[model samples]
Target chain A: MRNQHQNGTNHQVRHYQALSPAQINRFGLVELGSSGPLYRFCVRLFGILALLGIVGFMMRVASSGFSDRAAWGYYVATVVFIFVTFQAAPTVAFAIRAAKGHWRRPVSRIAELFAVVGVLNLILLLPVLFLIPPITGGRKTFWFELHWLLPFSAPGFFLFFGMLALVVCGLCLLYLSALPDFAAARDAKGGIYTGLARGWVGSQRQWKMLKSGLNLLGAFYLMTFVLVTTLFAWDVSETLVPGWKDAIYPAFHSITGLQGAIASTILALGIARKFGGLKNHLHMEQFWGLSKPLLATSLLWFYMGWSTFLTYWYGRTLAEQHVLQLLMFGPYFTVFVMSFLLKFLIPLLFLIWNRVRMSIMGPVLIALSILTGDIFEMVRLYVGPFTITEVGHEMTHVPAAHLPDFADILIIAGAISGAIFIYLVSSKIIPRISLWDMKEGMLLTRVQSFHRAEVLVIGKPE
Target chain B: MVDKSILGLFKDPDSTADAVDSLRKAGFGNHTFDILSGVPYPEGTFGEHGPGHKLFVFPLIGAICGFSVALLLTLGTQVSFPMVQGGKPLIAIPPMMVIMYEGTMLGAILFTVLGVLFESRLPRPGVGLYDTRITEGFIGLLVSCPEEKIGAAEQALRGAGAEDIKTESASGGGR
Candidate 1:
């Protein structure tokens, strides 16, 4: 839609024609049903990789039994990497939706779709749970001596249940958010969508309930995400390393998760816009809007990391030094550098620019950088600690960084690919764009002439 | 004097709002009619009464139940065992707080989901006086009325530019 210049001014105003509700519903349903050859090929490719991940996992398990925690360093790192990145992606949906950012309407579904990956991560977490020794082994753990009294292993027990709660909540959030779209498909085609929709009729009461449910679930999902992150950080990484008791570490891990979540969401949005036939729906506004948070999280990542590093640096004791060497300067120095630059330094330097932050590719590129850094960061955090087998209250020695082998590489690539594979399959079932959200956005927004330029007027209802 | 359900479809929101206003003017109370749309127009867009819900109560109740159960499990287990590990008391409040927190959240989340389902009256046996076009940008104003007032309801709906009207018996099939 275009508006002509009429007041003897040479300024041309461009008006956006929002997609009608019917068009949104029809297009979303059609897109869900029909996948291009390229999309199908990608899905198959990822499916093969996912199978390879299973093969890699089995190879590792067979070759090096669960007794050797050192050998499974990369394995645990890969699982945590997935947990913090793809599994954390839904947090962006909850955060943006809770903040009532209208630009998030198109992006929220992209973020929420990543919840399906939580199932895969939950399965990956089980073996890692077994890998963690009980808290009774004279190791310093949050559980103290609870392992002696409890029937099961304390760390593993808590980690498994915490992760399970997060996964279930995430799935519920995704399901509830997609209910309206299912009803749309049911209205259009009347097959399995009917059952999935479960008799949703868009009545006022249903809408009210749906809205309330989303808000509550989103809040719960966010809290559970933080709790789960804390569990992973403390039990898997912190408690594993003797004398590595930094209170800020769990918060640091959460910051990493939040950063990784935004990065993954941005990357997925870019891919969807570029290759997933969503060019018309996702615009530069979404990218620019997300870039602000990406920049903020980058700064927060540096802040948290620096705070932890500073504490260890100032302590200057042998125990603190060993802890620092294990995580930062000792064997995984290269990984720490790479993670620092990509996750914090590089994003900070580039995303600070107005020109870079305003473009579609800029934020996407930064997101890519952050995700690459997340892999290195996870390795540095999880693998280094896994190498230390000492169960004392203080570090006796800082072990060398355990490099990943062929199986570990497969596990890493396969895990990431498996997540993508699950996402692709899910996108087929659920409409990629939130159809109802788009329609509601269209209803709330109007483009009108403000002076010489056409500006959008958005309605914010209480 | 049987009750009948009537659904008046409107292409645009303004007409839907006008239909609501017209129904009220023609002796139909707010409780007798409801608006359905593909999009969630903000409450009161049609000047209809906002329905109250008990959704918030579910989470509160869940939190209380979860906290109570967690307190019992944590305190009961510790006191039953009664071993001081790190120069601490038999019942450690700090460590138990984690489990308690998890229990509280889990309870709240599960009950909130159930609350949504219950309050929404999901999985209804039948969708009465419904039109599929309502999901395709059309708005439906559904009215439940006595058989004697069907003509007046139809007149009010038509006066406000209803695109189409469908009526169904109280027992539930739309035609």
Candidate 2:
């Protein structure tokens, strides 16, 4: 009825209200200083838990230096940190943008903010560096010992530079994507926003540049992410364990990282919707849209995991048998089941239900389940390889089951809590939603009547 | 004599489209005016979309650069200090290929983004000819006319269904 003003040519004068910058500024971001009692409580709780975990990590490091048990605990914590924070969180942004999915707008910023966590990972990697045994005789690592020609390719230098580049690239991409919003914010609040909004005049040229920058940076980040994860898997997991050789394991590890990233993105979205006051901006549509990818990744997780198992299963050699015992049937058997079932089986079953896939709660729950499974999966992957104290071409004995000690528990708690704390802090600096992208979506979308139902039509740029 | 700039707001896209047509008929060239709206109506909805097919070339150039870098990293490093393993050749193709492919893609993507920014001249700080209402579902048509044709421009816009009109000096102050 509001659009009933027909022109002489019979075109309807649609009365759509565009949100002003003021309106957008009000709802586009959650106030960094303001919070509900629940949010305050959660932050405080996570903070205390994170401190305890950090204290526990210090104790573990002080008490057990290069000892097998200490190494196991460190490896456990490292895997958890990589999966939860660094690898998965930033990935959702790149994956969605590269695919050209319009629904990516809301959650992309949330994903990009995890770029800072890469710094935390670089710091956490220090202990792992100290523990890498001297590469002598039969221990062939992916890295060549050309310490003179390629000094940076050394494990420590390589990870540091790689992670540094990743963080820088991520920040650049984030800045470029949000340049318009920064300009909008700048016009309103001319302090820090002015500096950040440099060169954004909204000229036709700038818009083209922003679009191109996002696409290119996003592609570069995705490829780099896979390569980085592969390097981590190869150096830390495969090379450290004697007589362990699996070509597909590194690739499998990277795929799992992607699944974890999708899960982390979903979880973050659910939380923001509930508490960060993003309910209107983040809709069920985003959840449903993202669920399809989650499902595909879940299937891929199983396929990769099975491929590793099948290779070992079919070979049935003594060395291959030892790998099975260490990773699957030996001390890690329970964890293997959890990773296989929770990560793969249950997720596969629950996601198969259309009702579950369509709702926000269903995917969030599935994401949590998968995250839990990821923890177990990391433990299985790391603990097995770490407990092997001997280095030989032929593994005469499979490592026995090694349970997590108190240190492992503390470190794990600390790592996870630390991830939450970092995410919360980053949310303050980077808006939870890509405000400019949201505005773009608002401009492009219109409700049209379709026989019996009103369908939303999104205009695509030519 | 200074030129005059006139901006008119239309309540609907049809009226705005009509005004664009009228302004063109009045001898205001396509490049002399701009249409701003909250929605990106299809290109040519107003007239021709802004220039360039140069964006497509960025990825090709990037891929070539990336491939070159990968070749140098993989081959150059091995040649300088050969770390032969398991009787494999000094130049391993499979592992090198992966690095090369990733590098190529990275180059293509980065360059593509740069090309867009270069073409757009983005991050340009300062305002231009714009209206806040343009983002609020109002289609605004901005035009530059000679001092003598100011009346004719006003008449054309009003006849084409402009809801509101404003005229400003064709100086930097208009933005």
**Looking at candidate 1, what is the lDDT of residue A283?**
76
Write candidate 1's Cα lDDT for A1-462 as tens digits: 334434533221232456778888878899646989999999999999989988999899999989888889998998999988899999999889989988889899999999999999988888887788776657776664456544546777777877877888898899999999998898898888878988888989899999899999999888988998999898888988888889898999999999999999999999999999887777777888899999998999999989999999999799999988988999999999999999999999999999998888999999999999999999999999888889887887888778899899889889889999999999999998899998999899876767765667789995
Q: Is the docking of candidate 2 incorrect, acceptable, medium or high quality?
A: acceptable
Worst 10 residues of 2 chain B by lDDT: B127-136
Task: Give per-residue CA lDDT, model 2, range B1-175, as digits (tens).
Answer: 6677777888776887788778778887767676654443545665634644477688689889988997898788779878785556889786677567666766776677667666765445544555545544466777776878878778888999999887774434334
Count of clashing residue pairs in every prediction:
0, 15
- lDDT for model 1 comes to 0.87
lDDT of 2 by residue, A1-462 (tens): 133322332111132334543465556542533567877787788888888888877777777755544355445545444644455567688778777676777889878877766666666766665555544466666554446643233554444444544555676777777666666555554567667766454534355556666776776777677766776677666776766788888788777888888888888889888888877567676788878888998898888878888988999988888878888898778888988887888889999999998888999999888888888888887767766667666578875677776777877777677767776776665566776676776667676665544445677774
**Candidate 2: deviation at residue B73, Å?**
3.9
lDDT by residue for model 1 (B1-175), tens: 7788888999988888899899998999988998888899999888889988999999888878877877887788777767565566777788788888888888888888889999988876556678899899999999989988989999999999999988885424641
User: How close is every model to the real structure, measured as TM-score?
Assistant: 0.96, 0.83
Residue A128's lDDT in candidate 2: 65
Every candidate's DockQ is 0.70, 0.28
The best candidate by TM-score is 1
